[model samples]
Structures are given as structure tokens and as C-alpha cells.
Target chain A: MSELVPNKSIYEFYRLVEEHHILLAFQGMMTTDILTMMGKNLKEQAEDHIFHRRIFSVMVELVQNINLHSADKAYSESDKKMVGKGIIVLSTSADGKIFTVASGNLIRKSEIESLRQKIDHINRLSEEQLRDYYLEQLRAPEDQDSSGLIGVARRAKNPLAYDFIHVDEEHAFFLLTVPIHQQNSDK
Target chain B: MENFSIKGSNYIPTVHFDAKSGVLEISGESYHEYTVEFFQPIIQWLREYLATPGREIVFNFKMVYFNTSTSRRFLEIFDMLEDYQRSKKGKVTINWYYQNNDFDMLESGQDFAEDVNLPFNFYTF
Candidate 1:
């Protein structure tokens, strides 16, 4: 390997993240310990108690989903083990009125259609319908589907935004974005 | 039966099941990576304890935050309690406590109450 200096690349990435108004960002292996630490840091950064809790709840669901569903894997140096790899970004609107918790992870191509349908279905439900649907899903058998995303939509009280960036015939990068309005935050 | 107690951490809830007193409680946060595995022994213990007939069980859930998977385990526990109560085997009451001003927590308790047949009482702390 040739010796290389990448200070410019580092600064460029920093500028890019800063330009996005990102409050917190992580890209690498996802694990329970890392999630706990990230949650604590995010909570401490927020001034409003309720706001922090709501955002924390959304973040937990998104991060854990990555841990459970992401098809990409990477070696975590600190953990000394391979774990799911993903990216999570917490950003706020320019007006500081809304916060968005977004995550990106690679997933198998076959899973994209079902995921799309699930998000579309969740987006269409009224709050009451969502609650009823959530409770209904809770009573269903333990299948790795539906409940978590429904919880995210219910807690957000807003439509979930998502995209599937096709990478190859067998895989795609899945991105999920959940928005939390500061005004509607009673929890 | 031996009393079952597991101390909590930042990611796991503290579970204390007093077989003698028949007051079972799970408090604190539960976002364990292996949530199903974590609750297995606790559920198994409840199963064995309920095998003995005519016992009154009071279940308290005071959770600060729990992941969706924990919610499923909670339902499993509730189903078990419902079964125990329905068969004339035992008397069961569930007390769900949520932090003051945390309506989400309160609603979570309510949703669980709606799903099962057991009697439920909600309290704000």
C-alpha cells in the first residue's frame, strides 16, 4: 500500500455533514452497546425533555431495525466482532421546528417490495386506525414484520418516508426517514 | 418456588417476581439486544409458578422505555396471566404504572389492557 494523506477528504466529509444541519451521525457497525451510548448522547444534547424522549424512541426503533434487518456486515474493531453495518443521521429543519431521524442500510432485493408495501400501508392509516392496527399486530404471532414500523409511524404521527436505492440485482440500499414535529410532541 | 429477580441496567429492566408475596414487578428500561432470550427464563418461571393452583398474582409494569420486541414479551406474559385467570386456577390483576406527563407510556399500558381479558389498573407515577 502506498502512503496517502486524506485530510482534505476528512474535511470535505465534515463540511458535507455540517451543511446538512446534522446534529448527530454514525456510520458503521450497529450494536446494542453503541445504540445505548448514542441514545444517551442524543438525549443529553436536546434541551427539551419531551422532545428528547420522542426522538430517542424513534432512534431506538430505527437503529434496532438496522441491527436486525440490515444485510450488510462489517467488523467492529471495538466490539471485536462482525455486526450489521448502517448509517444513522439526526438532523433538524432549518427553522428548528422539526427533527428527522434517518437511517440507511443495505438489504436484500427480495425484501424491498414487502417493505415498500408495509410503509405505504402504514402511511395511509389514520391515527386511530394505526393504533388499532398496531394493537392488532401486537396480538399476532411473532413474525419479524409490521410491528416496529407501525410503532414508528404511530409515534411520529406523520407519514414515514422511505426509498430503495438499487445497488444490484440481489441487493439495495434501504433508507427510512421519520419526522418528529416539535409542536405535536406531547410525549 | 424460589423468588426470581434480575437487576436492571441501562438496556435491561429489573424484574422481581416474589413467589411468596405473589407481587411480580418489572421496572426500568428494556431494550435488550436479545429481548426474547432475555424474557424466556422469566416467562418459564411464571409458567411454573402458575402451575400451582389458587394463587393470587399481582403484576406491576413500570417501564421507562422498552423496545417493540419487549412489548411482544409483555404480551406473552399477559396471555399467560389471562389463561391462568380464565381457567379458575388463580386470581390475577395487572397494575400498569407510567411516569407523570408521559402519555405515550400511559397509552402503551392501555393498549396492552385492551388486548387481553385480564383486569388491568393504570396508575401514574
Candidate 2:
């Protein structure tokens, strides 16, 4: 019989991430405090000022989406709060010319279609159009479900790549990736 | 009415609205879980103040960062100010202060300025 070694698998996973130049990665319950701390860390670590602001802004919205809309919730050490469970990863390209932020969380199957539609709509807009849409949404009445993904698209200045994997009858795993190109100093 | 002032927390902004001075200021970062709930009272106070607003009102915003939820609330406040201005009740001025190097914050101020019909004075620190 083959031996099942869990420790080796865990070690390999970490080794893979380290080799990829991952700046930060977290998988588990996400809270506002944790989000703030992560933002601070990223701000301090990012070499480019513009990239820091864009990434920090985009990360805040992404994590907030997970916190507010994730179907899966886990109890934190403090019983007073219920944290949302999700995964967020930030990594740099092998050439060190691009940074990508990726996140995934469980969402209700019923909401996946609409969410997909919103991302598609955002992906199709021009930068000017996206800015106009963002302003329009800002003026509109509050919709809790809307995380203002257009704002994310504007900051990223790139298409939002996303996918949905069916988890079960009622839930699906939603994954989103945003790529921010690092501008050369000469430009 | 009594003046309202709440010290800023890690996730919520500091709100200082002085009834006597007619100087309303919101500063710091805001990304509260229940954004609307936290700002509802402040909105109410603004409404009440506008009913019999003083001669001059200056609203200052010096926010380092805020989530989309908080941005919506800000639009609401701007809408209210516009309404007050349309009524010609008093002179309303908005001071949007941003860090000198923070272009995003400057753009946010410009966005708000475009949406509302008011004299939005932008200051860079």
C-alpha cells in the first residue's frame, strides 16, 4: 500500500508559492481588521507608489466582496464576529513587470449568473466609459450586492478575468483575477 | 441641537459637525461593515441643519481612503448640499483635501465636483 504523507504535500504547496514570488497569500476567514493589516503591509512592500494605491484599493474591494457576499462563514476567535472564509493571493510575474491579485470564495449558485454578467459588462467598457459608469453608480441608490466592480476595473486598468466552478447544487466557487501592469520609469 | 462629534476608529472616519460653527468635517479612512447605519445619523443631522442652515456652511473632507460603500454615502451628502444650494438657503462650499501626490484622491474630488453644482475647492496637502 502507498503511504499517505500530508506533511510532504503541505511543504510542496508552500515551496511552489515561494518559487512563484508570491508577495502575500491568505486562505481562511477574512475580517476588516485583517484587511486593514494586509493593506498596510502591501503599501509598505510595493515599490511603485501608483501600484501600491491601485493594488490596495482593488484588494480592499475584493476582500470586502468576500466578507460581505461569501456564502461560507467561519467563527473567529472572538465570538462577536463571523468572518468570511476565502482565498486571496498576490504575485508578481516571473519577469517582475506585472503584479496580479487573485481571490476566490464560495457564492450562491443563483447569484453566479448575475455576477458574471456584471464582470462582462465591466470588461467591455472603455476607460472613459468605465469612469462614467462608476460615477453613475456612486450617485445611484445603495445596492448592497453591488461591490462597485467597475471601480476595481478602473483601478486595475485591465480586464477582470473570472470563472465559476460548480461546488454543489446550491453553491459555486467564484474566482477573480486582476492584473496591473507595472509602468516603466521612462514613461 | 447639540453638536455631533465622533472620534475616528480604524475602520470608521471621524465626524465633527459643529452646529454653532456650521463647519462639518469628515476625515480619516472609512470602510465600516454597516456603512449606511454608521452614516445615517450624520445624514440626519445634515438634513436637520439644512432646514435652518446658517449663513455659510463649509464641509471639509480629508479622507485618506474609503470603500465604495462610503463613497455612496458621500454622494448622498453632496446631493443634499446641492439641494440646499438650489433652494438658495445659504452659501455652501466644499473643501476636498488630498495628499499632494495622491492622484486618485484628486480624481475623486473632481468626480464629485462634476456631479454636483457647487463651488468645490480642492486643496492638496
Candidate 3:
């Protein structure tokens, strides 16, 4: 809607989000780089036992999201963190109740609807159903192996909620708001 | 006392464990494809070391960053060290070091200390 030029406004807004709320922000040129920045961020999140298992599984989902949806035409999901190409943010909400992680990159207008449908479908399943499906996928071999969004759904199961913001249909930003597991809140 | 090294990929960290020096370091950037596969050998080594007995093992993690999969392996390694320390076969001293302002790394070391009941001297420069 605004100037195509990199908005100082966008960077400033990103700064505001990171300074005030983020537990971690995988900002500045994070496209489909599974090896570098985003992977680093996921690894940090998975440092804990809970994350080592559940959250990591969810991260697989996010990775898939990058793999499948990243609009960049030149790179695969498992490549470099292209400048001005990808943005992934991992953070927690103010109440400490939600850990929100999201990513964005260029994509085609035609593909957006299908991806939206996929995310919506994944989000609708019950916990039991989701778990069973996760197991099914787990047993199955890696067909696509992007960020395991389905895996994230069942494994990480956003504690708060998962949201998304579309920078137009051509570029959509996905936000996953997961709550801190209340059961393991002591740590 | 076997020497092993695994290359680090964009998605995983390389693990080089040296039994001769009794110096086992999980250093460098660690973001692995599969947590289980990458860490399985390190876990196996620690277990085998515990059984065989040897000099006190030293752990140095000058890691820039590690993913969740590697963290699990780190935990397992810490557990093995604790077991070694308690058995008294050899001493295990962990110098968990980090840069001056790497809060995540510092806190992570603290978290490990709490979990393993090991006295992790958290140092930052």
C-alpha cells in the first residue's frame, strides 16, 4: 500500500516491537536460511527441555512455512538469509503468557490463498486429532520438510494463539503466539 | 578414548570430542537438522566414558548459538558429567563461558546448572 522502498517506518516499528516485547527477534535479512539466523533462533528457543521437544517440533512447522511460503523466487527453503528478503521474529507477549514467533518474505499472489487454507486447516484440529496427525507425519518420511507447521501446532500448540499479518497478498507475515506451558511454569 | 568429529551444517552443529586431552568441547554455531541424530553419538560417548572411567573431563561451550536439538544433547552431556563427578572416578569441572552481554547463553548455563545440580561457574567477559 505504501512506498515499495524499505520503509524506515517498518524498521522503526520492528524496533519498537523488539525493544518492548520480544524475547527474541530474528530480524534483519532472514529469508529461507534454515542453516543460519532462523535456525539459530529456533535452537535458542529449544534450549529448554520443553522447547527441546515440543517447541522444536513447532519450529519445524515454522520452518516449513518458510520453505513452502517464502515468496522469494530465487532461493530454496534451506539456504542463505537474503538481505531484504526474509524476516522472522520470535518473542513473548507482555503478560509472559504468550511466545509469539512469526516470519515473512516475498511470495506470489496466486499461492497465498492455498497457503492460507493450509494454515487454517491445520489450526482447526482438536488437540487429540492434531497429536494423532503429528504422529502420522512423524512416522512419515520428509516429503516437503519446511517448518513443521502441523508439527508446531501439535507440538508447540501456541499457548496464547497464532496470528498473521499480510503485507498485501504478495507478502504475508505469519505470527504464531504460543503461551508458556503453564504446567512447566516453575522453570 | 575415541576421537570423533561431525561437520556442522546450516541446520546442525559439528561435535568434536577428544578423549585424549579429556577436553570435550561443543563449541561453535549449532543448528542441526535433526536433534536426535546429531546428538546420539555424543550421548553414546558420554555413557561409554562413564562406564570405562578416565581423567576428569572438561567441557567448553564457546558456542555462538545452538538450536533445540543440540540443547538436548548438551543436557545429556551435563548429566553424564554429573554422574562422573559423583562416582568419584574422575572430576568434572565445567567452565560455562559466554561473551559479556550474551544473556541467552548465560541464562542457559544457569538453567543447566539448576537441572544437573552441578556447580556451573557462570563467567562472562
Candidate 4:
């Protein structure tokens, strides 16, 4: 058996996360129940009502992407469902002026190109254009494969940052980061 | 038609549609595991209601949050209402209620308002 030893690298990573004021970080099977519990906890922890709702909405959408689309899955006996395996980190900027939700999961390499194109298209649209796109999609035929990426774009109202890192010939790790500005105290 | 009402759960919103009064209200949060399954009945009810064509139909939305799938169903409801209005079946009004200072909710209502021809009355509680 290999001896378990504390690594200095882990200490450095912990320091980095602490310095960023990360609110929540989890790496495991993500189920709807867990998402709901996390959302409830976040709602209680967040002081600003509007920002709290924004954070909750963004978190739900991001986690759902993993739950529905991630190629990596874990069976949960409690929920009697296949849960997505992924890592998610919710953090505030060092200045506490903005919040960022980041999630990573394995995805089929074949799906990357279309996903990338969709994100790129959303990034190019103006707010007005985005609203139009949202409505158009809302009226479109229901596709279970659809991840409602437009809702994420609409809530964040910022260009989504993403990367696909090659894992194998058939799969890759998809990482997505969404940034939301904290509402001004006066507003 | 009999009145329809469903209590809200952690993942489903409360629905109250008074057949006698012609007022339909949905409130609380909705992120159901099976979005279609949760909304199918309500959609069917609304369809039947529109067939009768009341004098005035008022739909109220007081949602705290809803997933994108639920939003799509909501759009369907709006389309049905729009059809009813266009056919001169009734005077349709949408009342969207939100907490004060919740701009996200307010803006969401505005977004829906823009998509439909009917005006949405915004109320803050």
C-alpha cells in the first residue's frame, strides 16, 4: 500500500482559494438534491438579496449543465439516479467586487465543436439580440439535448469563458467560467 | 370546469387556477426534475379554459426562480394567451409580481412582456 503524505502543492492551492474568498467548492457527484441544498445555503449566506438570487440562478444553471451534459457519471444510491461527476468553485474577487462560478467536467470530444460555436455566437450578440435569441429558442421545438445555454448567457450578461482540454481521443474536459458583477450597494 | 390547484414543493411551483373567477396564479420556485411532466396538466387545463373563452383572463406570475425548461413552458402559456386575445375570446391581462429591488425578476417579466403583444403589469411586494 502506498503511504499517504500531505503535499505542499495542496497547501499552496488552499492558500490561493482562500485569498480569492471562495464561497463554495465541491468535487464529486452532483445531484439535483445537492444543487438545491447548496442553493438554500447560499441564499442564507448571501447578504444582498438581488446578488443572492443572481448567484443562485447562475449556480443552478452551471450545475445543471454538468448534471445533464457531463460525460462522466456516478451512480447515486440515495437518489437512485446517475449523477454527473464534476468540480465546481464559486468565488468572489479579491476586492469582492465580482463573483465567479466555474465548473469543469468531462464531455464527448465530438460535442466540443458545436458547443464552442454556440458559445461564440452568444458572445457576439448584444443584450437586445440576446433577448431575441432567448425568445426564439423558447419557441423552438423541445430538444432534451438542449442545455438552455442562452439562459446562462442572459443571467451572466457577460461573455462566457470556456476551454476544452484534451483528455483522450473520445473525451475532453470542459471548463466554463461565468463572472457576475456585484450589485452596487447604492443601487 | 372544476378549479385546479397544486401546492408548491421544493422543485415545483404552486399553481392555482380558479375556473369560476378566471384567475390563474403561479408562485414560488420551479426547477422540477421532469419539467414537462410537472407542467403538462396545467397546459392542458389552460387549453380547455381557452376553449370556453371567459370574459376576462388574468394570469399572475410570482415566481422566485425557474429553470430554463420551465421558462419554455411559460412561453407556451403566453402563446396560448396571445392566441386567445387575438381571437377576441377575452381581455387578457398578465400580472407579474416580484420582490422590491429584485431587478432580475423584474427584468425577466419585462423580457416576457416584450415577446408578447400584451402589456404586463409589474407589481412589487
| lDDT of candidate 2 over B23-111, digit per residue (tens) | 99999888775677889999998888889844588999998888788888898999888888878578899999987777778877888
Residue-level error in angstroms, candidate 3, position A86: 13
* iRMSD (Å), candidate 4: 2.4
Q: In model 4, how large is the Cα lDDT of residue A25?
A: 86
**Model 2 ranges with Cα > 4 A deviation:** A1-5, A75-83, A144-147, A184-187
RMSD of each: 2.1, 3.1, 10.2, 2.7
Per-prediction TM-score to the true structure, in the order listed: 0.94, 0.89, 0.48, 0.89
Residues A123-142 of candidate 1 have per-residue lDDT tens digits of 99998899888877876776
User: 1 or 2, which is superior by DockQ?
Assistant: 1
DockQ of each: 0.63, 0.47, 0.06, 0.50
Q: Each candidate's iRMS in angstroms?
A: 1.7, 2.9, 8.8, 2.4
Kindly give the stretch of ten consecutive residues in candidate 4 chain A with the minimal lDDT sum. Answer: A141-150
Instruction: Judge candidate 2 at residue B112 and give its lDDT.
Output: 86
For model 2, residues A22-141, the per-residue Cα lDDT tens digits are 998888887777777887788789677656877778788888778767899987774256868899998999998888999999999999889988889889999788878888877666
* Model 1 Cα lDDT, one tens digit per residue, B1-125: 99999999989899999999999999999887667788999999999999988899999999888888788889889988989888857999999998887777888898888889989999987
Residue B29's lDDT within candidate 3 is 60
Model 3's lDDT to the true fold?
0.57
Per-residue lDDT of candidate 3, residues B8-124 (tens digit): 765555667787787776666665545566577778877776786657677777765554435556766776778777775777878787766555466557656766756666676
Better of 1 and 4 by DockQ: 1
For model 1, what TM-score is found for chain B? 0.97
TM-score, candidate 3, first chain = 0.60
Q: Model 1 chain A: which ten-residue window has the lowest total lDDT?
A: A74-83
